[model samples]
Target: MLSDYFPSVGGQRAPDAELGATLRDFVAQQQGPISAHLRHRHTQTNEIGRCVALWPVLAHIAQESGGAALALLDVGSSAGLNLGVDAYTLCYHCGGASVHVGGAPRTDCRCCVASCVGSAARSMGCANLPVAGALSHRLGLDPMPVDVRDTDATRWLQACVWPCDLVRQQRLALALELARQHGWQVKQTGPSCIEAIHAWLDGLPSAVQPVVLNSWVLCYFSEQERARHEQAMIDLVRQRGVVWVSAETPSLRPTDMALPATPPHDSKGATLWCQVSHHAGEVRQRALAWSHPHGAWLQWLG
Candidate 1:
């Protein structure tokens, strides 16, 4: 709407909520003749601050769509490394199928969650005993896709991981490889994703349930632009019987205002996961949680 999602912040050095100038000073302090060639590395790693925050969103999609062939649109996906996360990893059983990757970092799963999984597997309704396979299937959409294979991009990708971000980076790398293996085309520069996604849906055949769609991209949009994009998505969901889920953290908590309510772009946005009919209708679910690819936890809204 305003040239780019950033509007016009001018050229002033923006203030970060955290990290401050530590990153700048850290690189400046380390120097050798070779260090002169690596000046830009600092800014690259500066981005890893809250990198892994996207996992819950991906996990939510897996549960809602279960097996739906989704056409994902990341509102402001940078380098699009997130899309690759789904492809390169696995879920381990015994302990309720925790995730594992050859070279990625790990997220400590709740032991209680694992116990529930084991119990469900042993339930009488589960006629197919001795489940031995891992959960699979993942998709993503990004307006800006970083070249996962580019040397600089890869290094930047590696640098962007946070101090304890072994799990995120490794998972992303695995996902990227899987995307290539499966031919998941990531569109780096496309028209407004709001419109593009609708058009793409037009070409899909009917009976595509859970037609799951989401936006993990707000950083790139101007206030009004984010609304337009979100509204466009909602309108489509209303027109076609499908769910529109969203998740955003409240920019500022509300007093006298309801908590864990339907998404409104005004506040920062919650880590929301919702659904709509895939065909003609106007039905939506505001309370839901992560339950996907594998039988993950399905906690309710707050």
Candidate 2:
């Protein structure tokens, strides 16, 4: 993101001619040790596109979970932007052919376009798609959660967007604005986010169904750590019903995990979307779609 946001790096076209070289130079010139900054900084790409792919699935789970308010636990939530999904509008362009629109919640600002819910539902092929209920408890768990209110932290969040993608940049700005308006609570997940899940869920009222979301987080963990986190989710289901949503690369998935169809990729890579349900003593996992990591578009597998 730095390469895109930093004036020195992105201002001149020549320096950005080769992305690898431009980043290397930028890192070398910084006064402090790069390692320390990397250790502390987390790319909280609270991507809106991801929500396009995820919202439908969330709606499905919410309906199945008795339609009460949710206690959302976001694992590896950098600035917890994803937690603000309900607050912003979503526009989905499928196959670069069809445009489906989804509305944001009611906002008082005049400049803010009142989000409406017609086209978005039509595009997803769900007539009565349920938007998530009021969040009784929204908690983000990250080793390094960015405080979106902080200027530096906010800039870092913007910097995480890809260079030259004006649409995504605008979406990021909107998501951040919504996050600022709605206060989101982020807690440290400690050494393992999986281990910390139980405590967070236990604290919420039983009426509020628990929904745990992780987007491209486990890839950062070692194989053993990944296994531990997966096991933790399974245990959460066996003990008490919960919904686990994940967006991950295929390689990080278990061998038994199935994709709705073979994944397609762009210049970036593949991101497979999945939803796991533990309802009525039955644990079920379904592959929903293949999408761009940041949710640029999605090909629904159903």
Point to the candidate with the largest TM-score: 2
TM-score of each: 0.53, 0.76
Model 2 quality (TM-score)? 0.76
Tell how far residue 174 is off in model 1, in angstroms. 2.7
State the lDDT of candidate 2 residue by residue for 110-139, as single tens digits. 110122121223233322345766667888
Give the poorly placed runs of model 1, Cα more than 4 Å off: 1-140, 210-212, 250-258, 261-270, 276-281, 290-302
Off by over 4 Å in 2: 1-44, 93-128, 263-268
Q: Following a full C-alpha superposition, what root-mean-square deviation does model 1 have from the true structure?
A: 12.1
Q: Write the per-residue lDDT of candidate 1 for residues 1-302, one digit (tens) a residue.
A: 11121212222233454344555555566557337557534333212112122233334444445544444444444554334433222222334443321112232322111111111122221121122222232234554455556666665655555434344455445544543455544555464675556655676656453233443445456777666766666667677644455533333111112345432222232333333334333344443332221223222231
Residue 5's C-alpha lDDT in candidate 2?
43
Candidate 1: residue 226 Cα off by (Å): 1.9
